[model samples]
Target: MGIRLPFMVLHAKQILKSTSQNVHNRNKYNVPKGHVAVYVGELQKKRFVVPISYLNHPSFLDLLNHTQEEFGFNHSMGALTILCKEDAFITLTSQLSAS
Candidate 1:
């Protein structure tokens, strides 16, 4: 069975995808074709290029929810900025990739 995502989740995903594409098209960032760039950290943010497929994962969606609460969709960064510790974000993505 397929998982159903909330409207907010889908909205966030679309925004992120659009922003990523724009950045790539402008030749401002070097994100690969099927990946997106996300800035993760609390104080000093670090950038991570992850597969766009991660957006479909429940855990990643939860992170997106937190990001929305903290930074909202219109962050000035012009990219998806996830308000989280870099290590924790890395661990979650690592686990997701491993599975």
Candidate 2:
């Protein structure tokens, strides 16, 4: 348990450093801590600020995989653009929140 502390601290420091680098962007969007802005939709993309914790869930990971396969990470929106309908994304997130 004690041995893991230093690695966790270092990892946290790295995250803080990267977050500091994006401070300007975060401020521009007013994104709250522990949340991330993602664009979801096919024809007309819509932005949604979702809990960062959702990334760890299998259902969310599946959506991410679909985005990766479709867009290859070079999103023109400059943010994560999920490849799914707006209603579908809403349903998935709602389900995640329920569970």
Candidate 3:
């Protein structure tokens, strides 16, 4: 498990790099596209996957800004269920406790 964790981290790093490059290239060419990049084992819950362009999207950015203003930090994958408005607090609390 320990060795696998390192390998997963390395693979996730490579995936993130590739995704960033792809986003950069698409932006340079003015392409209307987005990429879902996954970081496996980056957190304890298996993987962290999100749209690369979503980070810059107006709605998501607004939410992120609001979260930062309210919580003093950006929402993280580990804290998504905790911070997201749609998530049920009771369920999330139980899940978190189990973990």
Best by TM-score: 1
State candidate 2's TM-score: 0.74
lDDT of 1 by residue, 14-94 (tens): 766677557454486677777878888888878899998988788988887777766676766666788888989999999
Q: Tell me the whole-model lDDT of each prediction, alpha carbons only.
A: 0.76, 0.70, 0.39
> Candidate 2: where is the Cα deviation over 4 Å?
1-24
Q: Candidate 1, 18: how far from true, in Å?
A: 4.8
> Candidate 3 regions off by >4 Å?
1-48, 74-82, 87-99
1-99 in candidate 3: lDDT tens per residue?
334333433443454455456655447434233444322221233333354444444444444444444553322532231134333323433443454
Residue 66 miss distance in model 2 (angstroms) = 1.4
Q: Write the per-residue lDDT of candidate 2 for residues 12-93, one digit (tens) a residue.
A: 3454355447878767777678776778888888889888788767777777766665665555666667778899999999
TM-score of each candidate structure, all chains considered together: 0.76, 0.74, 0.33
Query: For model 1, which pairs clash?
Result: none
Candidate 3 residue 3 C-alpha distance from true site, Å: 42
